[model samples]
Target chain A: MSTLKIEDYDRLRSKLPNRTGGWVPGTAVYCRGYDMMDDLVGRVDFFQSLVLNITGQLPEERFAKWLHAAHICVSWPDPRIWCNQIGAYAAMARATVNAASSFGNLAADSVMYGQGTLPIGTRLIQRLHTQHLNEKKSVEEIVDQEIERKGGKVNIMGFARPLASGDERVVAMRRTAKNLAYQDGAHMQLALAIEELLYNRYSETMNFTGYLCAFMSDLGYSAEQVHRIFALIVVNGVTASFSEEAEKPVDSFLPLRCEDIEYTGPAKRALPDMTDE
Target chain B: MVNRSVKSRKEPFVKKASTNIWQEQPVEHNPYLVEKTHLRGYDFDELTQHCDFTEMFYLLFLGELPNRNQKQLLQLLLVTFISPSPRHPASRSAMSLGGGKTFPQHILPASLGIAGGEYLGGRQVQLCMQLIQDNHQIIPALWLEEQEARLAEADKALLAEGRIIYGFGQQYGEIDPYASLLADKFLGKSFSGPHLTWCAGLVEELKPYCIGWLQTGIVAAVLCDLGFPPHAGAGLFQLIQAPGLLAHGLEAYPKSRTEFPFVRDEDYDIVDT
Candidate 1:
């Protein structure tokens, strides 16, 4: 016998939807729990409303401004960046804008450049901070324990840029945060302490990602929340990359050659005898 | 501590009532702290230690962890649809992204986002699932008049909705053998499911119309057998295929970025405006 009763199932037919507190459907208008169309139609800027939607609360005006800093810093349109390259390829291939943005944003999850490491690092750092306060552990002791916990991979999260020796974006971001009076939170201090310790040991410097995570940690955003927030912040970079490609002629940006591609895999082989030869 | 579940959920749909697939601890601001996943009622903490990734994948979509057999079957399903040929539109999207020597991050969103078409990415299998759910008694048993009538209704409804049948045919009337083989092998092992059995019966019915069951049919059958709701089907396919998409995207990353794919395919005809 079938588990579903046709009568009951028919009465209950509907699409499963993820719930959200940020936006509520209010007939013809949408509500952000504040005001309806009047508040959003032209009153608020896109970035500010976005942050408000993300955290379920509005951030300080300056912090909303600081959110754009990462975009400005990381918005490299060079086809080498994964997100940009996808956009360029779509433009080159005469694919749609939808293809460029979807693929470009998806690329942000790659472990090296995007959302991959930040959340993991944020979680560990948050946990250690909790441990430090609750158990009264020193920074040095906490770093040592964290290093051991991560199996001795000493370069901790919210610190170090593998590509650039001195990440100038850090100075700019810090200044912006300071200007906004959102400075010297415990998470930021801990990040700096960790940065200092790592510098003493491995000479690695903290980059903009590290700073961004530190701010989120200080604001009580959990690792999972950081993942959502980070996606929001870096999407500007994704789009900036996308726009650069879409504007150019198809394949006009860094062209590729088929002949240069070396095949290291097994050469052409015959199919098994299961097929009638 | 034994992780206790607080809620139980089987249906992923909500027609007239409020339905949620994820639930958490009563405490605000500490969802994962004492979280309660709706389907299995597993404490969030316990899931981390006890659940393998394949089990986790099931839990995320179907809202409950799979048993050993279910897990193994799902693992195979995953291995099968994980990627498509590079010639596929989705793969073509990823390859195009890589042509610019871009980061690996950008390929998936483009490839998977708009992957909906006649083949593995289509809504055809989903429509078929709808058909089976609606007319289970008639479809599998060769109830010709009723099945045709029901299919005609569906065809009209689908036409009104501006959609086409996709799962059964990748294109107008073609099905890939590799996909068929994978589905066949999976069906061989996990035979207890009613949905799969019913789908087999439906295949016989479709033969007169010259319709062959495609990979999407196999996927729909397996998913239905596993008790997954209809909405989870397409998202699950994409999740399984993400890695394959990522791999192709990365492969194109280091190659020369100046190459024009469509441009090289055929030179554009210059005409006066």
Candidate 2:
């Protein structure tokens, strides 16, 4: 009789449909010498376990190593970086390390320049590549159309970072990828071609986002997974920055004089008519 | 023949609408290095130095600084309602996250996310605010009867689906003391807005149904008095409660790695249901 029919009960369930067997709790705990201990603790390393937990399969050793390198490349412990600054601010305010870590992690998850960019770039790369390969469109056509769509401000997600001639991180990540002998797949090749076209027209260099896009795509991770993993991987660096900054006096990390602020607003006006609405 | 997909978009109608309430500072550079907060372009330094937090809070919500009465009233409301008890689930989450040293970034957003659920810190206020707004100019006594009647028709439909009505009653059988204390204080205040009075009038009417006005109702009424949209209450409540979450998180900092109590297999008796 209701809009939600009896048959819809199974459809509304949050549980994974394919996994019909053992219970994988939201936060699984493993105790030494306890049942189901060896399955999580003794058999798999942390990264391997993380992959297994997220993707339902442990990646090969080479892929795990590559992932480790990719994690390290973004883990700059500079409190000056956007996401890390929250942690630093928390620390300086004499906030808890957990508070600092959690808030900093949140910064990566929400703000566009942090973990938000990874999924965005991944989606863009996949879309553009699909348009190029399957849709049989020229790179120029797609790039031009995208620029027009985004009001000509360059919608190419993985290139042309602000306030830099070029990122050194991309070079370092590529070097690490080479060291791991990680072959560039069709996605990466497509990204490189797009990058070349962008550079020729707009002087847009392939920033770390481009490399990250390629790396995540090569690992066969979906955009959402890439986003989550990006946050998980880079949070340690943000935590490090928070710990570093929290050592100083409250609000002392980058000491600011009151006069440094440019007051562009009106002078203080007195509030009128108290004791009545 | 080639089939090409054309680009599709919803007709351009405010592409990005975060609203006048809050916006990220447009500066692309190191935002913390210089001032980034634009509270209606209020000088952040001066605002902190001269104006009380209520004035700033008013600007945050209304996009304009408040008058003296508005400021003082808002301050009282904040004092009355913005209590983040340790027992609150959001605070509990913050404590757990902090205890585990999860990292600085996850604490506020994560805790606030916990706060923004169907029950607890969010939905009661949201529902109260909406009901109050929808029945804005109604005679409160009569309106209360109408509400009770309307729900009476739908009550069986709700109970069948395990849905308890929000904006009234307490988890415990009795009325919440916090709600009563704030109500006393609210009654004592000289500036009694119609919304506040309207919500107060509904309490007696609702009592026979094992429901009494909770903190969520009064807070919603006060916010409606202050001219915020009903929808903004939950998010604003979360924001106000953030410092309390931070405090809990900070308290948890020195503790050892303690995951929030997970259900152990042994703890549950798996007798046939």
Q: Give the winner by DockQ.
A: 2
lDDT of each: 0.62, 0.68
- In candidate 1 chain B, where is summed lDDT lowest over 10 consecutive residues? B264-273
- For each candidate in turn, the interface RMSD (Å) is 30.0, 13.5
**CAPRI tier for the interface of model 1:** incorrect
Which digits, one per residue and each the tens of the lDDT, describe model 2 over residues B138-178? 87668767667666776543322213445655544355667
TM-scores for all candidates: the values are 0.50, 0.58
Error of 2 at B42 (Å): 11
Model 2 complex DockQ against the native:
0.05
lDDT of 2 by residue, A50-135 (tens): 66656666567777776777778777898867778887888888777777776687677643466768888898888887888899
Per-residue alpha-carbon lDDT of candidate 1 for residues B7-94, written as tens digits (9 for 90 to 100): 2224364333222344433345642243333324444455666566787777666654566677777877788777877867788788
